[model samples]
Target: MKVGVVTFPGSLDDVDAARAARLAGHDAVSLWHGDHDLKGVDAVVLPGGFSYGDYLRCGAISRFAPVMSEVLTAAQGGMPVLGICNGFQILCESHLLPGALIRNDHRKFGCLDQRVRVENTSTPWTSSYAQGQELTIVLKNGEGAYVADEVTLDRLEGEGRVVVRYVGNPNGSLRDIAGVTNERGNVVGLMPHPEHAVEDLTGPGTDGIGFFTSLLESAATA
Candidate 1:
């Protein structure tokens, strides 16, 4: 699969994200924030970073990036799209996924290997993981708390759209939510840096490979 990782002006993890995709046996393509095309990639990854310098709000201005328009259209047509960290904020702002990410309750920036449980094994991003499996993924951010209304929260839980849950609620995300998927299961917004966990040599473990590999399997079937 050819996976595209979008790079905004302030994006810091686009390179790492591309490497993660290559590590998973996929061709990694670079997509620009101002570009209006996807460059024919099979999947898209909105890598973690303070896009547009996190001005106004995290991912606020990025939701209108020219490239995002292409992404939004592709995602709506059932293309696999994964948003990590700041990218998660962009997804929510773009209305491709529900809920919003706000400042952490601790009122401090944090960086750690977070433990999250795989809550939904059916999404394109989690099919490679076993149900209830726990993964240690790199998480770093100051505004990483996920928030949504009670009704939206209930629907996500009842519909099995909650993709992953933080083991310790480190960021005070409602219901300990770490990641979520759209109704059709093609779009996923995760507040952790899974791409940073793909290499055992550079990261905590190989637990994050499942995410990228899962895309291949899903695309093959789709």
Candidate 2:
């Protein structure tokens, strides 16, 4: 499988994400923000970082990048897309996923080994995880709080769109939501850094390997 990792001007984790994809037995491709093509990648990852220096709200500017047009269309066509941290912010800004990520409720950047419950295992990026499984991954961000109105929040809960929930209230998210999937289940966004956990020797653990492996398995089956 070929997985494309997008790199914006300030993207910090694209290299790690590509490495993680390779470790999961995929051909990793590097995609630039200004590129108009996906390079025929089977899947795409929007890695974390302070895109556009987070000047106009985390991913606000990065959402308008040329590559997102292709990503949005491909995602709608059932191509798997995973967004992490600032990438999650971009997904929300692009309207690929609902809700928004604001600053932490405590009004500070947060960094920790976060425990997250897998609420939906049917998505391409999450199929390796069993529903209700709890895994610890690194979470770090200045704006990681997830927010939505009551109606949307309730609807997400009702429809099982909430893909991952924090084990503890780490960022003051409603119901401690850490990740969510689009209605079609092809697109997912999470605040934690799964790529950072793909290597046991250097990372917190290899628990995050499931994410990349799940996508590869899904692609093979498809």
Candidate 3:
């Protein structure tokens, strides 16, 4: 499988995401934010970064990138897309996913090893894990709190679209949400950095590999 990792200005983790994909036994493709083409990748990953220096808002500027337009169309058509950290903010800005990421209730930048529970495994991005699996993924962001209207939040929970929840509520995200999946389960937006934990030599453990492997497994099954 070939996974495309999009790189926007100031993006910090695009290479890490690509490395994780290659480590998972697949080809990693580099995609530029200015380019409209995806290079025919099977899946796409919007890695973490402060696009446009978080000018207007986190990922607010990146939401209008040329590559993002292609990503939006592909994601709507069922292509799997994973957004991590700042990328998650972009996904919300693009309206491919719901809700918004806001400043931490403490009004501070947070960085730590956060534990998150996998709530929905039906998505291709998470199909390799069992339900309720907990992972200690890296979490670092200034504005990572996820917020949505009560009705929308209730709907997400009701439809089982809340793909991951914080085990310890580190960022004060509403209802402890750490990640979420789209209605079709093809697009996912996560604040924690799973790519940082994909290798035992560098990260917490190899638990993060499943996020990448799951994509390959899901495609094979389909």
Best by lDDT: 3
Model 3 per-residue lDDT tens digits across residues 175-213: 999999899999999999999999888988877889999
Tens digits of lDDT, candidate 2, 1-222:
989999999999999999999999999999999999999999999999999999989999999999999999999999999999999999999999999999999998888999999999999999999989999899999899999999999999999999999999888888899999999999999999999999878788988989999987787677
Residue 183 of model 1 has an lDDT of 92
Question: Root-mean-square deviation of each candidate, in angstroms?
Answer: 0.7, 0.8, 0.6
Residue-level lDDT of model 1, residues 70-89, one tens digit each, is: 99999999989999999899
Candidates 1 and 3 compared by lDDT, better number: 3
Query: Residue 151's C-alpha lDDT in candidate 1?
Result: 99
lDDT of 3: 0.94
Worst 10 residues of 3 by lDDT: 199-208
**What lDDT would each prediction earn against the true structure?**
0.94, 0.94, 0.94
